[model samples]
Target: MEITVHSSKSVKPDYGDSSNGDAAFASADVVPLSVFDKVNYDEYIFYVYAFHPPSPPTTVLVPALAKTLAEYREWAGRFGVDGSGNPAIVLSDAGARFIEATAATEFAGSVKLLTTGDKVLSLYPICDGAEELLLVQATRFRCGSLVLGFTMHHKVADGPGMWNFMVAWGQVTRGVAIDPVPVHDRTSLFARQRQDSPAQVKFEHRGAEFKPRAGGEIPGVSCGNVAVHADGEEVVVHRVHFTREWITELKSRASSNRGGAWSCTTLQCVAAHLWRSVTEARGLGAREATRIRVAVNGRARMKNPPVPEGYTGSVVLWAWPATTARELLRRPLRYAVELISREVARTDDAYFWSFVDFASSGAVERERLVPTADAAEVPPCTNVDVDCLLAIPFAKLDFGCGPPFFFRPGYSPAPVAGAIYVLKSFEGDGGVDAYVPLFSRTMDAFKKSCYSLTPPMADARL
Candidate 1:
């Protein structure tokens, strides 16, 4: 496949002093601060796939690519913002290369984009291997020859906001005008803090010190942030689908256990199930201990009324629950659900705020505040290493087109055995998509666990 590059048609905004009665800094026009800014992290990555029924003629693919770019430009014009909060229409060099390189390759292979300082640029091809992650590749066996893949930063927008941007781009590409432009009003949900608050959450960045103790053997698999060395050799991803009815039942069970706390219960139950499955796969008894962390978005749960949906500020809170994997599996599912529910509920209480304040004040050492394995004792013998589940709502994201066919969050290798569960609406049914990154050696075990869920087959490149 061949790829080409082009200069972005967008322009940069000037930061000169203003005259007239207008305030020098207008809140409405300024780039809204995102919650990502407060969190120390790298970029957020996402992938999009566009499939054609059969290998469209080269004629169709080329023009379609061009139209897509034009549409992207228009969408960027309306929704894109610069660091200074101006009508920034330009794509970073990386963004430009992302679009161009995909086109040149005829949508084959992955494009790696990196952010350095304030600039985003595309790094050249890192591998000629099979398409994994965001790399797009074409195959003769499939009728659809081209797909679009993208990796962008979470600092730019949330899932809903990103969907809105994509829908706008789609409409533009289809040569239609989008009416009733989507609002970016997130003022209530993610309001910016007047000043920087010191980090309240802490983790012992053990780096590579921790060793896997799954049945006295470690799996041989390694990703950028995680590694497994063992006696196994296959890696695959299974997408599991759950019916809306099943989800409702799960939710109902969770509510009954928690006296009506919804999201927390649903998430905790799922996490518990996953943990149990991993432990069982490794022939570990139900009583082995494990810990799983759940990310909680604090915007809506804060003492103050939530920021508006369009508010693009930082308002996320997180929780880590440490318990024996055996204990989680021994109790009724509701017990685990209730445990999660109560933990999440505590974050909204004043006590949680006090903890945050105390931690920030340096009264508590980072080690004391963060979760740590009991070094004095042998680490709990557990099959599952570690897991994190995120349950953010992304269905109402309408940019005047419709919902997306697939939405996958970026993968993190830092957490040994991490997975992201997303609720996707398909044919008006709520389906759950779990994005998991595992040690390559445990591929068979992972597949077995996913097969039990029986999710429909959709396009999963990574």
Candidate 2:
């Protein structure tokens, strides 16, 4: 797809009805970076949306949308990226970004054919500068479907925070009051006055063992049965669609065999199913060690001064569940679901509150803490990793023109056969779109073995 940039400029915060005289929103020009925000440092979390608006012939979409977004706290916050690329956000004076670009493609086709590494992603100024906390890009497709998206430094806000801002932007476009107004007081997790000791703040994330393990061979689970071989160009991106009906059917099949008061969430079911299927496709043996890494959002659960309803910051923790390839493949899907559900349940107020002190004390220099009720279960070996951004309301974001039908995270950090990104379905049904990158052979096997792609089976009685 060909694209051309029109204009790019910094947008200052507009303290209009949204501010409500709140000091964090109205007066505080410099918002201090919190522990979670700083941990991400200079990195960014990107979002892309495909919007089919009513006024297709109008030419003022970008400017109007840009104006609507820059008025809120989440957008106006500025990042202070020192030479090291670690970002800091200012509260009020910091401006967001306004970018206008034109894509030489139809909107629907653009959404269907989009990929993380495609050239169409060049429209955004992701690598342009470090000072801006929020960057906005509006691409007018030839078919008049506008693709609106933003890139926020991970330090400024997490996934939920980012979506909150986007939804609020939508509210503004509809001439409605912003509900659950953004509370930029990041002190809900950390104190504003406490100073970070110069030597205490560290950036390196490594293991805590006396001797960190070397070599790619993970020993917790045997690897003889592994079939994963996606590397370099051999790896390809493919999406597996799971309808609500099929998911419910799959979950029932797995849950029926297990006896417990607890059940699996949709996300747990999908991720576990993918893990097991991918492992099977890669031909990993039943005994080979396998692992899944999940990033959990810690907001409503935190106690003491709970993170406010509209607080925007990177409030997340990574939880890992390790199992043998046999356990993942042979066991029912609920087994993996149980592991994930339990892992997520372990993250509570104490865990996050402890993290505040843990981050400030420079404990990461010694070891990375994996919060779990059963720490004994954590494998002492390398784990196959899958990054998940599920359940966040991406498809629900409606900017007065109805909700977006497609949402793509823009980029992938993992190599081929190395990642799993689950989001809402393309049809906006009660389903999921699992964006996976696997090697050619593995993906082929996955297509054959995984029933997630098939249509829902009709009931026998029906």
Candidate 3:
């Protein structure tokens, strides 16, 4: 677990576009934050990729990263405040922080365990404050295996965008052309329409997303049966793997009782399964509400001038679905799936526009509000949020030898509960992996409940 840091430095873009022969943002420019980008102003996303021997060394990887950053200019920039005092990225070629380190032990057999513990935190470069929008660490093990770690502020890009950037870096390392050039103009993709009036606000942002629902007394918000976690409770991440057959069965069961017209999607069915299981494991009161915050991407939902596939930035919102514990347990799996599907369907183009308009309305500042999606702001115990990374092209992220044998969220020492990250299985068998963070006390119950399709039977056993 010991690591020795050999060198640390800021890496600027090494080259410019071949066509134009000019570096992007050659002169410093400030890119204003869109409504979506402002959601995670203080949060960062961490990624750890384990690469075995015969991979590109730091000598080549670092330059490839610099080249990749040249194309994705925002990653090489630093955060700053715009003229309006709104969060923005200063494209001043501030350079991303890169560190080269060495680990004494071999990394072949211990990728999973090494990443699960707090020691994994050493793999990532320091990203605190406004030091760097993007930071990377290359840790070479005794056996020549490399553990590449990346940390990017969520304000700079969402999960999909960051993944795309990672893929681009891999493409650069392999000397391949970067496919699907990224579009970084946040104003065009997410800003409120220029024709619309500034005062036009469609949704009640305070009630729906930000502020508490007029609860002068109740400690929990009913949005998704949100309740406070016990103070000093230990939260641990428990991973549950679903094979293709198990997923198929879950989907079949979730789709069984529903009308012929309403078959559940993969995400809906699996999320429902997890939601029900987690709720059952918690053993909440009959009247206690439980809800799951489903993360929905706004890219495909936008209309008119549609958001490009490669558009980069945060354009994600949560779909909150709630039901009482008794009702959830009493209902069939299909019922829970229907609830999830219905709520996800509600987050259409209109909903995204409403959020964009609401962000610019000055109401957020006036009300002193923050989005519940921010993990720091989320109510710890009763809340369950799901982030799906099923579509990310993990296999395409081949630097030289092959794609990463394993990839996962970097370990955080903080106690976070009820967040499930649905990822594509490393086996590439069309299966799924759910990394569930829960109170350590309920992990055993969750492990048993997650595999049971019949909630009644599962609850009885628990």
Candidate 4:
């Protein structure tokens, strides 16, 4: 299909200032581009696919196309990054193509279905030299459908920031003005120096070298299978909320066993539930070893003074703990929670620096990192599996559109077996929404378990 081109914008040239007695592109001014730059800025991408009803009329798709164009124009005005220090907005040919193609493909890909996954591979330098801050791509299928793809650098924005941009795009497409443009706040969550003494390491891990026993592909269910075939029905997202009381109880339970180590109750409980659910779905007994990793932010954990909150820089960290299924099930949930909590804490200490040192020391071959069968094996897991917590408040992210139906997390290459969970706080309800991606079969097992378990016990609170 011939995709039409729309309007484009670019950041003002003067935005980046080499003047004022400062060096060009101070480390502070430029957003860190690498995941290794910091711990808090975990790299991730979000994608949303809007599938039209089967055999939809062309007339209906035209209005959708116009709306999409308008939305891109407004977004170009709001967040374009200039080459210089000052933040200026600019739209590029690449950006325009990405937006127009996505709209056009909706009618071309014969989508019948859509999906997204975490892009775990390292990012290479942009060779195109486009002013666009995001890499948007779309693929059309033989069956009149489309898959819209967006690759955003974490330093430029977080999940909340990206959602804000989406909201603006949606509103502009609908021909509405966004009220009270969102403010970028960089003062609050400044990156702290490593010297700041703390009681214990926030997060810790066991078996950093543990590799998975199985190497090749294993026959399992796909997302499409679970969404369409498992029970032979359409799959719709269900937003859920947990009472504050439940959060408190979970925190209390986790803290009780750790001798009061600082741990995020939300992270601990969610991990435990997912681990157990997957084991049961695979019909693997609790005794089988499994490995899970949580991505952590390294902003405050750095030895350097904390970076200002609005500082667009890369701040990401990853921590993994591997254990046999038998041990995970045998231990109290609190134990697992403590393990996660401790691992998070340690990132601020010398251990975190050691990791950085090792990674920078030399060019490590990918094959060496790949696990062998005889190697002390741990169940496989990837960053794509864990739900990344976008620390920014959702309410703070306003891009013109009032809000979104839901903010889903997506990736490029699918993970081994689990799904990526994207968390967003609803605008009016003050509730948390998690976009979970799982194998079609696993989702089926999850639903069945939810239905069979007693109501109160089945609650995520437990």
lDDT of 1 at 276: 50
Name the top lDDT candidate.
Answer: 3
Ranking by lDDT: 3, 2, 4, 1
Candidate 4 on 1-462: residue-level lDDT in tens?
334434222212122221212222212222222223222332334454333223223333234323432332322223434465433333322233233332343332321222222211111112134444554443333344433445554435554445555554444434455332443323223322345543232222223422223455533332321333233432223223434455566567655655765556576665655555455544445445566667665555665444334333334555666666555555566666666667666556365555444433332233233212111121243222465564554343222223322233444223233544635453334334444444454566654542221121222212
Note each model's CA RMSD in angstroms: 11.1, 8.2, 4.7, 11.0
What's the true lDDT of residue 140 in model 2? 77
Candidates by TM-score, descending order: 3, 2, 1, 4
TM-scores for every predicted model:
0.54, 0.77, 0.88, 0.53
Instruction: For candidate 1, write residues 132-246 as lDDT tens digits.
Output: 1122222221223344445444444544444445444445435455322444433323332646643343432221112223233233444332333344333233345556677
Best by the TM-score measure: 3
Q: Between the candidate structures 1 and 4, which one is better when assessed by lDDT? A: 4
> What is candidate 3's TM-score against the reference?
0.88
lDDT of 1: 0.39
Positional deviation of residue 48's Cα in model 3 after best superposition, in angstroms: 1.1
Candidate 2: misplaced stretches above 4 Å?
16-20, 55-78, 81-87, 91-94, 115-125, 128-131, 191-235, 259-262, 285-287, 365-390, 394-396, 412-417, 452-462
Two-way TM-score contest, 3 vs 4, winner:
3
Q: Candidate 3: give the clashing pairs.
A: none
lDDT tens digits by residue: candidate 2, 1-462: 777788787766444434364654455555566767655424555677777756332234444444555445556655554344443464545567778888887776655557434543554556444567678887778987777767776656777877777887777666677766777776444652444422222222233111232335321321111222322234466778888898988778667755755567778888777777777777765556777777777786676666787886767766667788766665667678889888777766666665666566645445544223111132322343455666676545776678776577654222324456787776768787877766666678788766753322222311
**lDDT at position 200, candidate 2:** 27
What do the candidate models score in CA lDDT, each in turn? Answer: 0.39, 0.61, 0.75, 0.40
Q: How does residue 39 of candidate 1 score in lDDT?
A: 34
